[model samples]
Target chain A: MESFVDVFLFGKCYSVPDNLTIMGAMEYAGYQLVRGCGCRNGFCGACATIYRIRGDRELKVCLACQTKVENNMYVATLPFFPLIKEGFELEKVSPDVSVMMQLYPEIYACVGCNACTKSCTQGLNVMQYIAYAQRGDFAKCAEESFDCVMCGVCSSRTSGCRRSGTESSRICSPRSCRSPWRN
Target chain B: MYTGEILESMKKVEAARDANLALEPRRMTAEEKDALLSAYHPDYKESEFETLKIGVSRGDKVPHELAALLQGKPRIGAGDADLTKIDYDTDVLIIGGGGAGSSAAIEADNNGARCMIVTKLRIGDANTMMAEGGIQAADKPNDSPAVHYLDAFGGGHFAAKPELLYKLVNEAPDAIQWLNRLGVEFDKAPDGTMITTHGGGTSRKRMHAARDYTGAEIMRTLRDEVLNRGIPVIDYTAAVELILDENGRCAGAVLMNMETRELRVARAKTVILATGGAGRLHYQGFPTSNHYGATADGLILGYRAGAKLLYADTLQYHPTGAAYPDQIYGALVTEKVRSLGAKLVNAKGEVFMHPLETRDVSAASIIRECGDRGNGVKTPDGVGVWLDTPMIERIGGEGTILSRIPAMHRMFAKYGIDIRVEPILVYPTLHYQNGGLDITPDGMTAVENLYAAGEVVGGIHGRNRLMGNSLLDVIVFGRNAGRCASEKAKSVEPGALTLSHIDAFLKERGDAGIEGDTVSPKLLPVYTHGNPDVPKKPF
Candidate 1:
């Protein structure tokens, strides 16, 4: 009669058992892993978590090997962050929208703070793909920020998207796009 | 970074991709970059040519080589790893966690030793996180390190390995200032300098990139400075076999756990084998950008623990991958889009070869322009060429091909094709594995304290591999196999790891008679389910 679930992970509340998977509730809370785990399958975005549930003021984002562990969740993962890297010279920029408005001038400090599309747990629309990459419509900002698993949790609850999940890999340039055998 | 004295002090400098003499729409002549450096040389298929010309691809290993042809499989057997219950005991175990086992567990925990890093997956998933363009370093200002060591052992045909190509051309600009003191934001130049470009066989513009995910920003900044210097990793796990000690050295590794198919024994007095290479043994059928734990499992557990695997059948394909959508098929498209000028064309758009030549002559000019000068472009899994990529956003502007090939503008905008406005299709996949585990530029191998780094060590890029010389042979041999295996793990003394060297390497592959079926090329047969083509779903 399996059913348990407390969670609160890196903050200790454990319990686990039911519906597991926050990498099986952090190895059922003993946390043997030396670093945040990876490729637990949902395809190498290397985990990417960020949660909060206790009463849900809403701050989620998925992939701790594909979601699950919930009741009062709280989680935290991110794998690797502190992103914002600029490094210029695409021939002095010009693909429109002032090239992400002069290398992330915080994309015009958008105040429409939908707190990064209400903390996108893959519902995307992270402020409509930063307003479709500020209207240059980079092919619908590469088709609605292509399932953004940047996991900087909508650039840490964006107020204007400075870290935009580590500068959305500098206006996103996708990879591991699938195929080459692997169902 | 171009040299020949900076391409004779420049002239038509339209810039941003420099090893000078601008690419196509014509300008090359340094004797046409010395006649596109003698292009073309990929001949196999005589039933993969006597298993790659007399085994281990012509370096000759014979006796059940290619990692002792995967010794007696069915694991956890012989004493199901109780070896006095080691469950990990370290001084330096480190085995393949990409970007040379996370820079040899941060240079063996900064040389005081105690390192760990185990990995098969997670820990910046390997293929050095799909190394997108940039990581060759002669460190600009008319570059040196002897012209990046005469353009890396004169682009491989020189059959490299001279002191591991003089310690990867004298420690690649101090491993690019130690990956810019471990932050890896690379590109630089609004008066800050650094930015050097140009790839394939090169003579200068010493690569150095970060813009296009340069190996996912140096394998996520060396897996985040080896997990912020706490350095302990075991990760999903994999080591399969390698225990050695009774004087053959290597002492640790048996590990396993690829998701609880449990098994253990990690004793280490310094092992290292940085696992990489075997391009998932897809070998000559192609399609592979590697990284689903590029299964060689440390080259057949470091050749059943005798180690010395040079040129294990030359591989390196990457002359631009992505054979077409299906998720993003075979990945990679970053030789910084032909050193930033883009132009490989074919399907009648013309322009054959000389797209900066040199990845086995631009992958043997797209396998001789799609076999026998027919001029490629057939594609339903073969024959192609046409990288033009909207002429680097019409000559570097309009977000210059999404800011200098932003991971090929997010892998051709995941099939919707916006590689900064069209033109993508490519070929040559398989990318890097030039052959492995045969170290010694102080990265050991040949047994003793094991050691190996990056593409799982081999004759440092010899049967072709120049495009940014494998992220500068993974941080100058992962800081010389972590400071020479932490000064040989301080004169090692911790012994005891035996299965009598896997029963004398299975009685020396059963007295050199050699047979098959011990598997562990990670137990063969894995088309995995992206299986034999089905993908089409761009979402």
Candidate 2:
């Protein structure tokens, strides 16, 4: 009889048969997995994850796709973040910014086309920056949004506003002197 | 050499320089400074000084015969042959360090032959590393070598040589076992048996992979093994020509060190050319997954040495490469997605592929769809349809899919389209070549004492290749060539090769001069050849 292994993923634990790969284990646990583009060969550092055993005490950093599942092994997928500090400078480059926008536009999209600029409690250039960003001019957008106070008046009155009610309640009023753009 | 005309031309250049210097001290505004810089920049030509320099250079070196030669007139005695002496001696010399060469080196070492691998780049940088699918082998109980051979024959339209294909399929299992022993962590089933997956033009699940990075893993393992065996890998070394002995046998080869640009010679009992293929020649087919060094250098070398070159035109175009950001548009997307249940669909979400169609046919369908606009698909240049995204998501979740294929997800994400929610534009790119130096079943080329394997040799693939068979071919024929060459080398008499032949050859080819340019009229045809059908498109 083959030994079985238990692995946890997505807040759930499941038993995987012996000799099954981590990718196979993920499938057994009802998660679909695939190799990403760009040197899907571990060289690209994509698909990297955090893995640990529940009770046994060995810390190992391994590629999820490359590692085989062990009995009672616990694996967690970690978000990709480059280790080099200078690598963040890529954010300032236009091509890099454009690529990031293409990959995760949710982080950059501010679709509430601002009638909010007119209602700004601090009179910031919120509308202009949003317009620049919509046109894919991130530099211009960053420049224009340098002074937004994030008051709720724009959220309540703007027709394009689609943010959640909880988010609107946390908006910084002018009296607070704190910018909501800090995040 | 003492012509008055040369002296006058030199004087004219000196006068022009004087005039330019005399005008440099005038008070100039920013506009004037920009103009001056632009005019005198190193790239600037047609300036007075530049014109004079060109005139002087032309006047001093104008050969009347050269002008006629440039106008399609052949010069007499231009075919001067020079024999060069070989320097290094090895039992086996393997040209190209891709899958085939590395495998051959390992096998040769195992057979007790001193081997040296000469590659155009680092061993793993060839198109083999870009291969996304798995290596095909008859590993499952239901699968057999005969079935694998039949699939290959059918896929190539029976154009493949039956004998060579039989050897490939029969020997493939041992090759896979060798890879496993070398630490290639292939995808496994619950029983620990290697997981076999499907690919284009295959009836059975015969493909073994590590997710989509099958090639990279194989190359990495092979490279590690080659290094561990202490095989000398000469990277950045390109073989320029094969050196034939007095009896028309392949003695060795002349190589050009690409970095230092110096020439070196190797004399071996056997020569193996595993130099991969040529994909850059195609104009408008598909983006190439080939390395920059894959320029058919081995083919040219073999052809010049009188070895038969076959199937020079049958290039394989892989479907589904990214279409944006032109630098990487032609990179290969592993075909495992289809095996994992992803389907090819057009813009209207209709299944465009028969799911099991051959790769060539599938690529053609996608190209036609993009041309006709029948599907919402359009190649960036009306060349092919976009790969559907919803299908990928429907088969696998966005996060799950992204996690498995982080490279593809990140690439698409860079284009501002989440693959989970939006379709990705794709087109076929030149992925592989099915034809090259003609070789025997044992990987020996037509030239005596010469051998080849993997993508460098033709006939195994014929008109088309079966999915997963490429890696199999590399190991199977690679080992065969190595073992055969080692046996042959043991019996061959050691002969003397003098340096005089190489010196004469270099002189006839025009030695690299200190100041004078070395030009070759024979290179024009080779450099000008490219796929005429591909249209010029801006990145």
Candidate 3:
């Protein structure tokens, strides 16, 4: 016997089978996704999503393909957010804070707010890494944020989140930096 | 949680860890590997494949599922599309936006060609991003391109085309250096020396990585370079069919908007098909470690465009996919684990075959243990052997697994399985498509003005690919295809565009009485729960 749960996807309610991931339940309810889905594993951050439980006031961000459904869960896929992206030639750029600032000056605008840190789906110390970037300790910043999937949840939460990622990427010398997209 | 008996077996594995650490199994010779592959490898099983009835590959044996798609009808007819309306015009049109496509676009743009990238998903959303092991490059003082060529040549069983193999090996070091110059942050030692490690079938430790996220690092770097160069990338748009000129030269492709179902026309002087592989087909009913878009889109598209495929019958099954804890089944457990000193142990908690053999040999050994010997640990979903991951920490010391393979550790941790303290069950999962469109050393396919790179181009790896070479293959051949295609684009002009090749392909299938409900270039695989029509395990 199969149990069912009510999931509100983009404000439309559907009774989906229990034990299905949010992505799976959407498909089970017959939504052929054209967007907000990538690797179908957790690697690609295409399926970044925000949801809330029936009684909880707090919103949670997660990879929809990896998170299981809860009864009365409210789900909405995160759309693409247009952010400031600068372009530069890698051969000419130096691994210094000055180059990072020249490309993205917005890193100085970080207010030390923990909003980006709390909003990270990958549980990275987003604010701390950003501070490291601000202090020109980019090697430390690169190590702390190596596992970031660049889901942009952090950027959605704060003003300085976008450039912080690109800052760490700029400082990714022969050090251990694995930015999902340094751009 | 593991079953009680499985837990009991794990205890045995833990107890025997010290012995397993010192265990040294003899490596198989070429002839021995050949005998083992013939007797155990799934590719050698004749009943699993059938001869094609239509198209250029007619009478050639291939998997039945693929044969159906190969014989599938064209999505658009010759007269259906408006060839007069070209939305995007470029000198080089690169299909797919994975590593290969990105590499192709970068080099094409570098060669002074107006290039555009079109992908089914986001630019960096690809198997390349999901590749967890490392990239191969022979740059160490002791390792030369000659040695690298011999290692790769012998690894592929000497069946690899010498020209393509030579190009791949010779240019690998340069490719690595290019990526480094492009801001790809490779792992380095304390003295600023690049760190290299061993991969399966490698004589020297030439594998360079950005920790466990080698592919992600490389992919993100290339994608950033593409964006930095202002290369036009059409996201969420897939190339449904390749368009050819009236003179039978490759012109461009018909692009489909995955969301709006709108058709877009792209006209170009040359087309580079880097559309990647077919693991999403779930060949042999096995779970795959591919991205959602790895549905063999390039194979069918190239086939319809009058290109010849090589070794379509062969596929690479990665030996260490997670097989237990049903939720994460079929996810990749990278070969880096084996390279890091993990051992494959059977039900009796004993070390099995040498874990560092080629993927095919390693997968066959696992299958033999699970099926023929009945030594696999059984659960409701399937059977799998244990890969002693804790041995990595035992060998490399504490914090090794966490730092070296963070993504892997996080994946298991999500399922409440701490791999640092225990072993994980593994089974062979469909990993790579070893063969595709046959190409020259420079990535020119059978069709003029059509080039291929990455997994779509076959014959570079012969029947099997070694670890790290795939990442190298994308950059090496992708740059070659891009640079050569752009140079060729300078002199040639596209004639009147038409879908006559697809029309001819469909007509051939119709004449052969080969009918299918499916369409070519299957953009996305259908995934639904509890489809009794599809077998659970074909093997």
Candidate 4:
């Protein structure tokens, strides 16, 4: 027998298959959620969200990439920007030059949304560097990126940005990014 | 003018003219002149130095007539020979690339002797990288080395070597300072003092960490230091046999390059075996967190080389690993969790062990409870118990918990359990080995030229190792063994071993198995024959 799962996103509820992941079910429901450069193995913590199951009063947190959809579960996707100040660690960032280039393109996608810049506890210009990276000027990007402690705060806030798509809309598709070669 | 032999004959004439000047000259025959010209200027056609004009001076000059003779040559090897097979006569050769081997390499290098490190994996990929707890040291104002030594002795059931234990406790703080100088980012307090926390079987808060990844941090720093100093690291090279000379002094080793199936002989005056513990041979349900490559290669190599093995039976089982069905089921849950105030509970949600008891005792109690199924708690997966999450939430905020311990959150989520809201299913798993190749306080083995350190050595952790002390053991004793090996290496000369001797060494290794065959079936004899009656613990 196939089990049906009802996932409540924001305020709307939709039924999904038991086997589909929560991120997969959200896409099937026709809502477009902004996905980051998805390293779906769950180490990146890019797709993290606050979730709760209906009638199960406990609040839980999980990465949407790894979590499967549970029946009658409530998930609120927090944008990647707001979480930077609280969750970023300076030490985890790779000092690789090539990885810096791969992250350059999306950094320019910042729309002057001070949401990430202001959210940075490290006081970095998250908005300015994104603009610089988008312009193909890396020197400026490197300069502004200095303050980034790589807490994933900017990514966390922008992950579910309202401007990219409607909050009610589910986004389930994975984004493509260049792979960093292992030396 | 002069023919080639006539010019050589003129050199004989010059020698006769300067008989009182202590000069001897010989005339070249026709064939010899041709050979000398061909050999001295072999690459004359490709010579860049041939462009230079020759001149003569009274004091120091080259005769223009001999300009062709002075032309540079392209040096070629005697034949198409394998340079990697060229025997390097060094004073010491260290095996294993974890804390012990690396320390020995640094110590040997600083002591002005040629040193080489052959590791089964990358230099830093040993159990040292997987250590999550901080290193323990007696750095607190309230703590003393005597107290620390007593604690360690008591924990090990007094089976630890008193001298080694004494050296480890006293020098551990300096080792920590050495790591700091090497750029290990230890967690710090507001006043700039190193942050200390608690762990199993400790009276003081002596554990220092970089969040939960203390071992990773230490290994990274040490690896960087090793690299910066230009120490030769032969990665993916497994030491298959310890080479013993006729006199029975530990000499060198035969290594198999894992990438290429090639056999090479490393001839050294001294050899140090720093291969880590054997943790993967245990039965199921007992989590062996050791890397797949850690199969007691060092122990077997040392034992075959005639070094006496000690305390091979005592294994330390960490009390908290994620329960079954998870891929990392037996993976370590940092003891910092307990230090942060998490408690062990049975299925009925009652705290079972006296939360402050030693790790071995607590682990035994948990094992007993799971076996008995008392307190309404049945083993979840033959060894499962539960950890109360409410306490974890109270001590570490949910944000801190979610951020710092993302794995903990993932482990619970996999089981359909929310750690923030419910109890976590846990069990004891193979964590660390308390025994290995026996060594002196300076890490010298019974074999004259051999030494051992890190998890590969025994008596440092008698029965149970404190949470943070494992990292300290790697650095402190690793440095000690390294220094000792270097001193021995400096005074010693590479012994004379002929081609026939090298062939014999290669033949002995050939009997072990195929070169670079890590999966050789011949290993069965070493495994099945030893300690048959004793129940093996997962390490």
Candidate 5:
């Protein structure tokens, strides 16, 4: 017989197989998810989740597709992140901090709470990359934030900058817009 | 990440590295290659394939999983979708939002054609985003399109269609230039010369990349370009069935809103199916290195619309998929690792095969090593050989692995395995559908006005694809499909739209005595862990 563990999905308790991922456990509990599921692998970043252990106040973030179920785990899926990307022609723009400021505008609003860094599932130094964007060090920001999956966990935990800090790090990357400084 | 006995094998690999550096495995002769493939390749296992009972290629043999999908019933009845109530209409309708679809939309828009993209997931969520290897383009002075074509033809065992192969190799350099103009960051030297490397079966250094995130970077750039062009993209919507016109030319498709379970009709003068490969089908129950949306949707829809398939019996298994750690099983370990200098070693710390062999030969050799010789490392979940990754750092000095393949380093690092310091366990995983809907040089299917591109179309890579050609194939054929479809759309008028094809398909299946309880265009794979037998129904 397969051993089961009790997990609370949005505060409702269900017993699912201990070996299953949080995604599989949700399905085992009969929830046919439409939104909080994507590329069952770790690449897509569609299944960013927040959870806590029983009687533990330390919150953790992970991709639900990758995390295994734990006994008495409390899970919440963040399916949609409110991101309204400001459109700009990548060809005409340079990878400068001023361009990022013009597009996002809120990059200066970061209060250095470090919550964004703590919430990152990819383990990226979110605040450090944002600091790079602030100082016009786009190359450094690009290299540091190359692993960003755009999961929006950093924005979800922030109060001042919303998503601009993380978004600026991505915009600085040469992958999106070219840099005249680059040889 | 290895410990205990596996770590001991790692030590053996380390002890043999200096000697293995100079090792050169003998190349296989044509007769030897044929014998090895026939004996070990998954496609050569005759029992795994079955003849199709219905559709344009009725008697063709495809894998058993594919035969069922081809013979399966449509998701909806003919009466359920009203073609007259067109929800969205455009000059060109592009299905799928991967690299091909995005490229098609951009090209069509450039030709003054109004294009609307309908995709199952958010834009850029197709298999194109998962590709890690660089793209092939014979732009170097030492290389020419003729040489690239010859290499590809030989690698595919001379089964690739001549004209299609010619077009792919010829257009590749220009395709790379196009992506560069659109801001795709290819790895380049200080003087702006593209830094190129050799992929499997390549005679010259023609593979261009932006490190290991080559596809991700290209995809994001294309997605940005598509968005910036102000093209309308309908996300979370899939084309469940193709709508044929009264004249039997492909006209439009029935779109399913995956979230709302609502059906909508998209009528277009020309339709392009860029829906990608069938890796997510997990053919023969093999773990796949495909995106979740790669369930052979376009193949099923196109076949039902009377398009013939080419080389449907073949699939390409990427030889280096992560074999240990159940959570990350079957994830692709890019062939760039080998292109940079990593070698494949058996559990006994012996260099088994030349690392740069074509995908099929490499996969077969790995299987032969594991099965025939019992030279694979046994794991709790399965068996795999060592992809001696640390040799890359040793050959190129430290920090090379981090600079060149950071995505790979980070992927393993997440699981507590630092690939820069340790080797990874690997086995072949289903990676690409080498065969799909047959198309002309310009990507037009047998059904007039309908087009296919990317992995959804076949004959570009006959029975097996070399490492970097797939990325090139998408851009080359994608632009072809888009330009031709747009030009064709200008001269044509939208004919009567109907879903009578579904009725005809069902009738044909019934008449052929093909009985099965399956419905397809299987948009997603079911992962209800506790209830494996539950039917696949959208939430």
Candidate 6:
């Protein structure tokens, strides 16, 4: 018989296959996926989940696709958060600090709490990049977040990494017209 | 951005190119191709390439010793005899997540079957994503299914299966409609007619594309719909074995989690194998453009489940894949580049074979020219012909390279080679498998409940597939398999497990006293430049 580990999933206790990842355990618990799952490999950061024990206060965050679910652990998947995005003509925009603020003003909402950096699936220093964005240093922020797959995990874990898809590449990609500088 | 005035002028250039295409690029006659093939000793039987198990073969009855490598793994007991657990149960289980698998899943779901997709990678990460060429479909009045059929038939050297070929060309317009309905944005001209272009062997402009990322556009659209429909998918799970019922009917499959290495079973009424090609097999000592998971897993699974394989020895080597510049090695340079009027010039600045010849003949001509006649330019990477990309910009004008072939332009640009100004060195690279599990026109395998679609099945394009027919092949057969399997699933009850079929297969092989390689297709020799056993180009 396969060993089963007890874990609290969405507030219900269920026994699932031992040594299975969080995504595997959630499926084994009959949770049908609509979102919160992207690459299934760690390449996409969509499945970032948060968890904690019943009595312990250590709030833990890990990618559900890679992290194993522990016994008696309570977990919840972070839904894609709503983020502000100001659309404009790419060729017309000057792509400066004023444009960045006008496009995603939510970048200014970062607290000193480093939760976004702490919970990053790609090991990106979200707090540092948020500071860079806050300081109007688009190049530094783009370099720090070059590998973002826009899984939206960083945004779900923080107030500052608000917008995804466009924001991640807009601040970074050389192909984007708003890139800090051409490579 | 196109206007009728611009199109009228573009037509003039196209008209001029059409006039000179014959004289400028000398077309190789059939006799000429046969001579080249003869010089290269064209059979893939490995007598010339050392003991490497690479090369092409026309087909012969395999002696028992060499047949064991193609057999499936030993089957597990029964569907439920072990009384352990059924990890998943669905009305229709789709095994791959490429364009075919996604399209099939959508159609099956539409037919009211509970469908599940199991893939070896992320649902969207497939060779379908890597594909940049347009899809072939007879959507224009000037082009018809008959014309497409004739082109495909001639391209395959008349070796393609008639029924499969007929269905492919006939159902193509409807397939394009299905894709459009599913939100695939095909490229269009000023008059809103789908942009049509010729591939290697086509007679007319019939390929409907989306910029250069036609496959990506269609694949991502289908993937989004699959998500929208809430169709369950077990990503990163490879279908390692097919489960058979007591009567030798396929009941379901055994899946292995690629990352966790955990074994899981699925009891499904119908199994659709949409896993793509075996280009990674590195047949004939060529690098491949297939995805990482294109290792014939579905072939091994179906062959093990009592399915008869077809044309098992043939492989498709696309004519112009990146052979120089180490980083982008083996990437397919879309045939659209040729359709746009580029030329293949040798190191001596002499024009080689006609740029528009079918892949097999064209690839063979390059091999004979470079490896045999020593006319190919010696580069740090390899000897090859240069595909004059700048000629495309010259013919199509300023933004043509950026708009029509952006993915390619962007890829080369990243490597510091501006294709608009310079040429790209290319050679033949393994592209597709012309042989796979044999299936009927309706996508039914020899096994009662087993089905197949996409590049996984064989005999659709006999010896060679035309450039754009692959995208057409996937959707046409994908929808057929999905709809048929769903209708069949609606009527059939849950099947009983059969362990006897396994005993029967092993007994048959044993009674025949089969010898030779019993290794998995994954165990086949792959040739990278660093590998010591990499076969040298056989002249």
TM-score for each candidate, following the candidate numbering: 0.33, 0.59, 0.94, 0.61, 0.94, 0.71
**Candidate 3 residue-wise lDDT, B382-489, digit = tens:** 999999999999999999998899888888887778999989999999999998989998788989999999999888999899999999999999899999999999
Candidate 4 global lDDT: 0.58
lDDT of 2 by residue, B1-539 (tens): 11243234323333343232223222334354345334422112222111101211122221221211111111112122233544677999999888888888988998999999997556666667666678999878999999898889977868888889889999888888888766666767657788787787788889888656677667766765676567899876767667766666787777766556567778888888887766644323344666545656665566545566555445577766656433245666667655655555555444555544666665655665555455533333343344544455555555646534544554455435566655455677777777777787767777788888878788887777777888888888888888888888888754544223333433533432212332212111121112233332210
Candidate 4 lDDT over residue span A9-71, tens digit each: 875897765665565566556543333212222323345566788888655655564567888
Model 4, B1-539: lDDT tens digits are: 22343234333333332231222223234354334323422112133222212111112122121122222110111122232364555677878787667877877787887788887656765777667767899988999888888888877767888898999999988988877765566777667699887777788888888766667556655655566567788876766666655666677776666556466678887788887765554422255666445556676566545455555555677777666434345667777777776666665444555554556665666766666555423332344666655456656666655544544565555656566655555677767777777788878888777888888888887856777778888888888888888787666654543223234433544563324313321111111112234333211
What do the candidate models score in CA lDDT, each in turn? 0.64, 0.57, 0.84, 0.58, 0.85, 0.69
Task: Evaluate model 3: give its lDDT.
Answer: 0.84
Tens digit of per-residue lDDT, candidate 5, span B1-539: 78787888888998998899889878778787788899998989999999987789988999998998899988999999988899998999999999999999999999999999999888888888878879999999999999999999999999999999999999999999999987777888889899999898999999999888888778877888788889999999999999989999999999999988799999999999999999988888889889888889999999999999999899999999989876678889999999999999999999988899888988999999989899998876689999989989988999999889987887888678898878999999999999999998878998999999999998998788988899999899988999999999999887788888889988998999988778898988766664765665542
lDDT of 4 at B293: 50
Location of the lowest summed lDDT over 10 successive residues in candidate 6 chain B: B49-58
How does residue B214 of candidate 1 score in lDDT? 68
For candidate 3, the docking band is: acceptable
Error of 2 at A127 (Å): 43
Question: Per-residue lDDT of B1-539 in model 6, one digit per residue for the tens?
Answer: 11243234333334444344344766777787667655652344444222212112213332122233455234243342332368898999999998899989989998999999998666865677667788898878788899889999888878888999999999999999887765566776667678888888888988788777777667766776687578998987877667777667777877767656577888889889998877666665677777656767677677656677777666777888886554456778888899887877665555676888888887887877788688776554576777777778778888788778876775566456788876777888878888787889879998888999999888999878898888988889998999999999987776675545555655655665554434443412222223233343210
What DockQ would candidate 5 receive versus the native complex?
Answer: 0.44
Model 3 regions more than 4 Å off: A1-4, A15-17, A100-102, A158-183, B29-32, B531-539
Fnat per candidate: 0.05, 0.01, 0.45, 0.00, 0.37, 0.00
DockQ of each: 0.03, 0.02, 0.38, 0.03, 0.44, 0.03
Q: CA lDDT of B41 in candidate 5?
A: 87
Residue B460 error, candidate 5, Å: 0.6
Interface RMSD in Å per candidate, to 1 decimal? 16.3, 20.9, 4.9, 16.7, 2.8, 14.9
